[model samples]
Target: MNRKRCLILGASGGIGEAVVHRVIEDGYAAAVQYFTNEDKIRTIQQGIPEDQWAGSFQADLSTKEGLQAFFRVLPPEWDAVVFAGGHMYSGLFQDMKEEDMDALYYVHVKSLWMTARHVLPYMIQQKQGNIAVVSSIFGTEGASMEVAYSSVKGAQNTFVKGLAQELAPSHIRVNAVAPGLIQTKMNGHLTLEDLQALENDIPMGRAGTPEEVADAVGFLLSRSSRYVTGQILHVNGGWC
Candidate 1:
């Protein structure tokens, strides 16, 4: 008997790492993908037992060829896919250059589209699989000074919704998790005051944890959410 397998992109990030642990704990094999974090990737691999079907691959998500190459290295069959790779660029819309927009589009929108194009065929052929993409609250309601980042994420949010409807007949469910103000390396640039100000804005009065978002991913990928698809689960501690 072979174990079910999952492919996690951006496995070195805070939420991605938590999702990896959740999937493994749920008794599924995982193929972790990371870029520019060899040490962290190695540590994560060591934590998994050798007998489990686990492996790591490195790929830049800014190009189609890179995404294709990443998928080429994975197992032929995967029961689920969690796309957690994205980049954030903040600046006033007028100050944002074309290059900045291009970079965000590539990482947040194009790469995810390419990865799904590459992997969806397998899931469609099997007529059963789960696909989850990590989005952000900024996607839902545009963020100030982060116009490009918000736009790209908004596109992703729309993509998952439309894709879900199209893939439903084939039994391939597509959904997204939109996180708000999660404490991660991504937020390292923020000052202490900035953090507190953002926390105050949330109705729940604090930022969410990667583990909390990961648990949402876990639910969407499990039997519990078997009938749930084409939805955006917001894990934003009441932050709109």
Candidate 2:
């Protein structure tokens, strides 16, 4: 490929969609992973120049079969992989269910580990690769009603740090972008009063854009951040 190439997980989501554009804008061809929204993936894929469209894969990511299917479909080599996929649970801890928690674990933590494992052989052989995870500020500071979600985000943050160091000698860079609060469908369930209240708490008094987070991610995946790794770059309007 003339430019760098990448695979981004969760292209159907708001942040994922924005990152796809940003990666392409920075001159990278891409492959996208979608869970149940094949239509959206097709739309995004169609928008890219045919030459820059790598391919698309669909998988649950919360189950072994799905992860295997997804990984099996990946090209033998790519310049980067962005774990831009996640789920959120925003209710009191008492109401959380066992199955839901398991889903959170698999999607946020397990999938990342498995992804790294799947790509390690290729990246190590190439002696270089970039992994940028989409994390959230909730991971840094606990949120009152989102204990489980925050916990998962915290796990992602810690995992990025550990993995970066573990693979640094091989020249593979790992980093994460923790969006403070973003205006996305994930937060669409929030009541107007709740969103406004949350925004008021942010120092900048606004929710961030997915494009902003994507830009930070683009930096991590580019030569610009060659010397940077194992860090959580916050994109949350200074909320945390």
Candidate 3:
């Protein structure tokens, strides 16, 4: 039998990379999506066994054209779609530029909706599918200095809930993994003092590892979560 096909967006990021490993281990033939990180894409490809590596796609998901171009090359029969593509912006709300907010909206919200819409027909035809987004803990309980990021992530959370309900009847599961504080490049800017202060607040007293979050994503995308849908699973180390 052919292996289940899984499309992993933003597969070059820390969490995305871990997710790739998890999906392969869970028996899915995986394809990856990246933006401009060809070097990282090559690195990710090297890690996966050739037989299980589906393909790699590059697209700027912050624009409709990019998404269209991406799907043009992406096959239509994916069993799962994991949206792990996005960036974080931190600064005072007042200091934010309109363009930055637009990019966030496009990347974190618009592209996801469009990607789902594009895949909906195929999933409905097959009558089974999985959609999981990598969201953030700040999305659940708002965070300061991350107003735009939080807003878009909150939108992502709501999108998952609404889309899950709509797709559940069709046997298409939609959910999100809301990770608390993963040690990824997104937080590479944090100083030692900043890191310590943040870690002190978490009940676990440490940041989550990308693999931990990937474990959650893998579950939601597998038969293990057959009865689950429209849920935001938090991997926050009991911080919230």
Candidate 4:
């Protein structure tokens, strides 16, 4: 049997990197997508066997034309699509600038919607596909000092829910993983004290690992989750 092709956006980030490992371990031909961080991308590529590595592309997903160009370079068929790319800006709502809002909208909301719009038609035509979106707990409950980030994530949560229903008839499954407080470069600015304080709040008493979150994603993409759709899986270590 031919191995399925899987596309992972933001493959250079912590969670994205973890997803790439999991996908490759599952025997899929994987493609990593990124807009920047060529060094990290190169490192990830080196870790995978050449036969399983489908190469990388740099595309700024903030524009429609950019997304079109990104997709134009790929093969017409993909068995799975993972929207793992996102951006977060934490600050007082009053301190938020227009550009901040635009950045959040472009990365967290618009890009996912537009990519899904472009990809789903092909999935529908093929009559089989899976889409897993990575969201944050803020998307469900909102977050202080993270107004723009929370809003975009909330939109992503709703998008997954609605898209799951809309695509189910075509034999396409859509789900999301909402992770909380993972130790990624994204949180490098936090002090040890800050990290511990956040961890204490979670019933699990520790920050979730990217690999743990990736495991949730793997489950959603597998046959075990064949009957599941329109659901948001929280990999937050018991945190709300």
Candidate 5:
């Protein structure tokens, strides 16, 4: 298998970390992206050999400057791009402030668009590339308290589907992985009882691990799934 260079956005997050490792294990070099988590990024650098590490770039996906700064540091081309950086805010939609809503949109939706804008031209030139976004089960089956988060995730899913078709002619495949209930820092707000209640809703009686979702992303990025495009592969274990 040919080793491709992959740039993983949000490499400091829970799912991002796993995807980074999985991509590396698949024989690809990684360019890890981060916001403020320098420690984690450093850890990743330490684990991967210097030759296989394309280096990490810091950028706040929620800010225009951050986006531009990251793009400025990014290489002109990559073989694979994975968007795994996003945050979820739980609250009644009516109670959500304009700032919170805007943050969600910029972080989840805008960042993806902007990052792709910078990278797609490079991919187009190559005529072959892969893209993956980490979506949520809530994107399809909306959540009550997480209305804003759900909204943006929904947009991400649609973005993957639409962009996949538009880029397919160039042999640039795009897909998404929608994870149900993953044990990550994103769920740290939940109380034990709340967590138990949420777990009860899953048919599997448990939540998914980051590695499991990473496994799905790894498959989608591989030649084995080259025929697949514009699909939302659910890693929810029959939850939704």
Candidate 6:
């Protein structure tokens, strides 16, 4: 008998890596995708046993050609997908470079929409599938210095809700995990003082962990969440 398989986009990242492990533990073979982090994805692939390793894919989602090639190579029968790819920019909206803005839109908005277009057919045919995107709290409560990031994440949230409604009739579920301040390398730019200040604002007095976020993704992919759809499950520790 064959087990279900899930594709983990941005599997090299902190939350993505945790989700990869979580999906495997939940009895699904896992395929990992990464853009430039070959070493990191390889390390994650190695950690999983061969039976649960569904191979790795490298795709630069910022380009159309890359997206085309990625879909061409993806295995045809993925049981679920977790869009955890992220790109961050922090600056005044006016000062934001066009290239940075383009990258954010491509990664957060365009690629996500395209991934759904590519996979929804298989899911619709099977009459069951799961999609969970890694969104941010800033998506709902806009951030001051991260206007572009917040805008794209807001688009992500909207996409989740809209697509969920459309796919519900097909028995496919779509949801998002909007994380607060997670302790990922993506936040390496923050100094200890910066982290402390941010933590102080959270009611929980701390940031969330990647594993905690992954657990939520796992539940969304599981039969446990059969009735849960079109929801943005906030993993923020009462920070919002």
Cα lDDT computed for each candidate against the true fold = 0.88, 0.90, 0.92, 0.88, 0.91, 0.92
* lDDT tens per residue, model 3, 183-238: 99999989999999999999999999999999999999988899999999999999
Candidate 1, run of 10 with poorest lDDT: 67-76
Steric overlap count per candidate:
0, 0, 0, 0, 0, 0
lDDT (Cα, tens digit) per residue for candidate 5, span 1-240: 356899999999999999999998999989988888999999888889766898888888887777778778788688999999988888888999998888888899998998888888989999999999999999999999999898898999999999999999999999999999999999999999999998999999999999999999999999999899999999997897
Flag clash pairs in model 3. Answer: none
Clash list (residue pairs), candidate 2: none
TM agreement with the true structure for every prediction:
0.95, 0.96, 0.97, 0.96, 0.97, 0.98
Residue by residue across 1-240, what tens digits does model 6's lDDT show? 599989889899999999999998999999988999898887887789899998999999887778789988876677899999877998789998888888889889998998888888899999999999999999999999999999999999999999999999999999999999999998999999999999999999999999999999999999999999999999999998
What is candidate 6's TM-score against the reference?
A: 0.98
Q: Which of candidates 2 and 3 is the stronger one according to TM-score?
A: 3
Please provide, for model 2 over 12-66, each residue's C-alpha lDDT reduced to its tens digit, 9 standing for 90 to 100: 8999999999998888898898899888998898889888888888889987777
Off by over 4 Å in 1: 71-76
Candidate 1 backbone clash number: 0
Q: lDDT tens digits, residues 148-188, model 1?
A: 89989999999999999999999999999999999899999
Off by over 4 Å in 4: none
Which residue runs of candidate 6 sit more than 4 Å off their true CA positions?
Answer: none
Q: Name the regions of candidate 2 deviating beyond 4 angstroms.
A: none
Q: What is the lDDT of residue 31 in candidate 2?
A: 86
Cα deviation at 154, candidate 3, in Å, is 0.5
> Comparing candidate 2 with candidate 3, which one achieves the higher lDDT?
3
Each prediction's RMSD over C-alphas, in Å, is 1.5, 1.2, 1.0, 1.3, 1.3, 0.9
